[model samples]
Target: MPPETTGRAIFISYRRDDAEGEAGRLFDDLVRAFDEKSVFMDVAGIQPGSDFRKAIDQNVASCGVLLAIVGPHWASITDAQGNHRLENDNDFVRLEIASALTRNVPVIPVLVHEAKMPSADVLPENLKDFSYRNSVELTHARWNSDVALLVEALRSYVHVAKEHETEPIHATVPVQLPPPQPPQPDESASAKSRTPLFAGIAVAVLLAVGAGVFAATHHSQQPAQTAPSPVPAPAPVTPPAPESAALTPFIGRWQNTAQLTPKDSLLRLVVSNGGSQMLVHAYGKCEAGPCDWGTQPAIVDGSKAVTSAYQLRNNPQEVQLERSATLTLEPSADGLGVTITNSYQDAGTHPPGKALTYTFARATGS
Candidate 1:
């Protein structure tokens, strides 16, 4: 069997406030270079109400490559701790890039403005290598040429990565049948008769009885013979078989109300931007119910824009059933109201699934 193809979209990591316009253009170019579905552009791609951090992490993890859109202010931003931090080194970006790298996803550094390329001394220990790597410089005078080169490089990288992703599977050859031996002529007359000696005597006796009965009536009688039975052939052999999503930008601490019921309880879901994958942690309870911890898988599915699906973890039958729900996150047109559709499914014999949709305004101060 051939290796499975790793064809995927690219994740764009950049500081939105610092380079939305340029980043948006760069994203557009990338989409033109490859299947737009496989690329992630933060400027216009993220939806409102959905968990932006979670969405970004999931996108990066699932993508085939990570493109760092470094602008002049990329290294000037401060984390919550007020320390100047490179976007690539930011918690969310780090997680996304690290997850991709963990899976051998290619990473490309594209310089969007006049940001001084960090040297080994100034660069974070983890990003020192990227500092020395060649980058595409997009200045006003050479914007077109720089973009063309970046797109070309991205196209080539994706093409090669896709090739390596697919490996072929080989089928086993069938064994041939041995040649048949020639049939020998029967030496004994008894053997040539094709009937056992006892069976021949029995047939003779029956024929004699029939002759006695039919001769008396002047009817002719003859000995009876048996014909051979045919055997069926074998059948042919067969071979073996082998075997998200984007969400809108909802930046906030949202509660998982889908998990609540008349049984009495509430669950709090914190969808924050962790390094590579979304840091999804759940804590809360129905009236007096116990709380359990777990993680769920996410996917991207949408037409007008990319959508993300985050499946919640749920387990019942035990003393404490884990609360869970699926959130469909998508970005809004104005890039302010992200849509988050949360759904819930029941457990045991009778299960009732419920879905709740809402548009969340981006949290102030995010």
Candidate 2:
């Protein structure tokens, strides 16, 4: 087995009883695009003696992206007892998808042989978001063209296995990421400098209050100065800039109850540009790491909600990168959480997917 990836890795998830053949073909294609060590499938990469569930969850979380190869029988297949395969907690495909969704792994449903995207009613609660994620279709006739679209989008996240490849190149050029840069010492000093300013403002407020109290006490003890000279009020201290309306209830780390699409489908809301501008930092599941959907520029409306746009390569090709999420804060017993309503518009033949809503709890440390 190859050593695991420290960077983002591509994870291919498919049911053996459903699209094993197609999954194998897809794996071969991906291996040529990324390093062989960067692509993973099945128990081939699991070490011996590891707990099955923990191992699978660890592998799923470690991956930056997951390809859910869905074939016609993918959903309807059953166990020997005739129960639906998806209903079983131990079902590998179900477990894989559930983990990916819960952990915010970008799961691009790869429809094989023109398999239709599964409907929400057909899916279990945790897997319902699978119905709405943008999907790519792979048929024997257009396999190369279709896969090239998939490869082009994946380039944004995973490392390219080589500089040359045997696959047909009918689409875009390879994505080249900049090399890592050394951390500058000045930035840390700049970060340090920021602390004193805030501390100074707080100190100023305290001093103002103390002076006001002392003046009143001293005035009471002294007789009124000859003839009243009208004294102007002390200058009003400008209150430190109020926190952005966009930061109140919405700022924090949050994850969806259903656990759909990566990087907010709301991860974290942070202040940027020295708090002059508020930025929402979210992640979509990706290889080598979670693909940063970027710090979404957020605007707050009168409703006390922040609005932002998010894009990802989860569903690439003609239909790649067009999913959207509507987030709102909901008051809970513990505190405020979030609800993410996801919608997708496929630029290809596929129509707009249904809007799926998910409740998100605040992340423990956020």
Candidate 3:
């Protein structure tokens, strides 16, 4: 294979149902950071009537790295027939991964949406080796940092391939010359006698010719010199100022104006920028008085703003104690609203919890 075609690109392998959204987001970010032609996502690159397996194999072999996006249900998700998808030998995800591993390419398993690395026992024989590879997490809250690390890793391999492509070429040539002949002995005495006289005349003639040529050449080539200009001193260097807080669309006060709770219930959220961190203060009513769900820290990853779990101060005595709440900030379609999910449950629930979602409108003038 030519140096330009050998391990100079990236291939993305993902299950549609499991991580389609995450994979698309990653592809966009990668294209922005690197050459678009060097990044390949199957859905966008594959054509109609193409040999599917052959195309995947060729891409995997030519790519310097492969990113397998694994979502929460990636390993355990079932097909229409209620069978595990990975168990099938002909699964596209399995084939892509197996081909990459067989070719000794770098296969990075990108875990997203709380996905965990699968163990060897859960994988098919052809894909069992994938479990041992080191994985990176691309959470909604850490998308930028995670993708930056991935880009840096792939850059090294790309640099090596480019170096090979630019190597210098060398060539050689052969030349031949005739040998010299010896003088005759018969004319040696007379030749020697005339040598000194001829040499004196030859020397005088050569010197006169050389002097004339040198004087003419020097006169024609020399240019008139002018006075030298003064050199300017370099300006002093100034240190760069530190970056200020990033301005995000979510940086403002928002209030829950939705009507589904008690008449006295009121929810107010305040988001402020703090360099890389986003500070959030949420206040509301649980029954009649203030809901003491305290201040929280959030970070923006892509379009989503996520925060760590905070303990609710007003848990009912009959219910479980030590209950924690996680808040997720989702943007509304019109970009003028935000959906705040105040999830108190530890596990999955459709809609998460009763009266958990609060649609907040951006407070005017704040």
Best by the lDDT measure: 3
Evaluate residue 36 in candidate 2 and report its C-alpha lDDT on the 0 to 100 scale.
70
Each candidate's lDDT (Cα)? 0.50, 0.66, 0.67
**TM-scores, in order shown?**
0.36, 0.47, 0.44
Please list the residue runs of candidate 1 whose C-alpha ends up more than 4 Å from where it truly belongs after superposition.
1-8, 43-54, 79-81, 86-90, 159-366
What's the lDDT for candidate 3? 0.67
- Stretches of candidate 3 off by over 4 Å are 1-8, 159-366
Cα lDDT of model 1 by residue, 54-92, tens digit: 665556656666777777776567767887655444365
lDDT of 3 by residue, 158-241 (tens): 544342332111223455668768775667787778979898999999999999999877786558688799899999999764
Q: Which ten residues in a row have the lowest lDDT in candidate 3?
A: 163-172
Greater lDDT among 1 and 3 belongs to: 3
Tens-place lDDT digits, model 2, residues 1-366: 224633337888888888999989888888776667667886556778766677677788888888889999889999999999999988888888899999988777889977877777889999987776766678998897667656655654565536643443344568798999997679778888998989999999999999999987776765667987899999989978856654556656665455444433334333232143334555445433444443444455554354364544443331244566554544456555544455557536555555444455676776
